[model samples]
Target: MPGLSPRPEAAAFLRRWREALIGACVAVLGLYWVIFSFGLMIWIGWAVAAAGVVLGVAGIQRARFRAGSDGPGVVRVLEGRIAYMGPLDGGTADLETLRALRLDPTGLPAHWILDRPDQPPLAIPVTAQGADALFDAFASLPGMRTEHMLRSLNAPGGASVIVWRAADPAQKRLH
Candidate 1:
């Protein structure tokens, strides 16, 4: 007898969609409660189902944001700052001070150009270790469209695209 195992593609799909799968399960459970229960439980079930849908959508976005960790760097996001440690170069950028975000797909692995006023742009490879953290960081930017960012990320193009920009480029102060 031989042990059963998932194929490579199936395993990868599972790994990428693990959070979404959990969210779907939660939604199913909530729907079940909504169908079988009554009174306050039904309202609670509706809330639960809504929350699960939100989670599932976010999980899908996150899964799409993740490329791989085979690039030549490591990314770290802490306290509203993004730091990249690459083999040849590295830099840190404060999220609050960023002026614009661009995706340069001309490169082999592609690089995210984090631009700040009066400073050298920090370029982090999309496939760098922990690069997925950029999803949350970029999401925090006011007026950023997650769908646009995701589309630009996976789009086949040779030119760089601006994903986000500060409403008032001169206004660097948070307050």
Candidate 2:
């Protein structure tokens, strides 16, 4: 079972979930203070509290989205032989191996695109640091095909992607 076991990326998703939860809590606290400091009516406080709760829930949902497969860190191997442990509902392309990965920093939530021929691309939203880690890992793999680090887009925290290709240079494309 060489690739049967889940990859380290699975663990990364969980770690991100925890971090998001903590960040959400801090945000909620800040919202509470902002609302209370304004000294609005009791109803306003309740409204603000409700809003915080909604935001917290949204953050949790986002974490779950990322933790699931719908957000980021989702890896699709190939057709009929997909390996997705995240929350996305559909199956993925059956790739023989990872061919090329393109990082798109233009998106509000930066995206990672894995390119494989004859199959729809696999897209995942990733943090700037996560993208860097992915690039490093892919680069270290034996027989990696990627070559250039094309134009640097304005990624959060100045993160850039490492481009890889199987037969030719992967074109810098945004999804």
Candidate 3:
């Protein structure tokens, strides 16, 4: 039973599994709707199926995310606002006003460099507490391709690369 025993330290990582299960269920149900919408209400079925796909994808992505304690500090996201209280740097950035986002993995822990007009860039460690929530928040950005962002995030480390920009140039420059 020694191998079956749980470690106290491992309990923290238990938070990661719940989101994935929910995502899987959503995806399965959505796929069912898509495949079974053969004769009736095809349009509505497809529409709902699409929404489910989005939710499922986002949920799975967030599930796979883990904000370990190795990072400098913690992050909090609430009501569309992103805040970071870190050691080397700390700041808050409004998610709705985000103009650009880049991932910098050159450091020990990766950071999501959030840029907004009239404010300094906020660098929040990707592994900070609540950073997993950013996945859903990020999906709301207009014109962002979900698959592309996910691929970039999983890409090998290198110089900071801008993964997303606001859909409207005016918003990018003004906000």
Candidate 4:
């Protein structure tokens, strides 16, 4: 049993890629079905393969959103809030109330700035513990452009970029 356990670095690597690897395996199985199945089954296989491809693409983006958990804070996404407990600073941002999201790349490890209407912004390092959960959190935002967020997160150091902004309160009231 001990021998079967992966080494620390290997475990870390796998942890970072586990979803993508699972997606790859699913896609392969679907492809195999497409190759050897009967007529109706062949149609089913195509559907399965299509679903697998979508899962695989999402997994790849999630993997890209993951930064190592070696940074200075621990992030917790609970209910509808994201809380960051850092060495020198800490705060919480309610998803329902988040007004804007920004990427500040001036620090050694970049930070995600979560803005809420009445509170100071919560600055969470991209590499903080449990930061990967942010992918789902950010995705839940209406009209969030995920690819742009991923690109900005991985870009070279520069000025802050606003990744998302909540719709105007007046517009929401009209709806």
TM-score for each candidate, following the candidate numbering: 0.88, 0.34, 0.68, 0.89
Clashing pairs in 3: 117-175
Q: Is candidate 2 or candidate 4 better by lDDT?
A: 4
> What 10-residue stretch in candidate 2 is worst by lDDT?
146-155
Candidate 3, residue 17: CA error in Å?
3.5
How does candidate 2 fare on TM-score? 0.34
Tens digits of lDDT, candidate 2, 1-175: 5658666687766564664566566556656666666555545656655665666654554443231333444453333344433355323433345576667666646665666677677665654223333433444545554333323333244454655555434654657
**TM-score of candidate 1 relative to the true fold:** 0.88
Per-residue accuracy of model 4 over 44-119 as CA lDDT, tens digit each: 8888887878888888899899989999999999997898999999988889899999999998799999888877
Q: What is the lDDT of every predicted structure here? A: 0.90, 0.51, 0.73, 0.90
**Could you give the candidate ranking by TM-score, starting with the highest?**
4, 1, 3, 2
- Best-to-worst order by lDDT is 1, 4, 3, 2
Q: How much is 2 displaced in model 1, in angstroms?
A: 9.9
Winner on lDDT (3 vs 4): 4
Q: What is the lDDT of candidate 2?
A: 0.51
Least accurate 10 contiguous residues by lDDT in model 4: 166-175
Instruction: Count clashes in each candidate, considering only residues at least 3 apart in sequence or on different chains.
Output: 0, 11, 1, 0
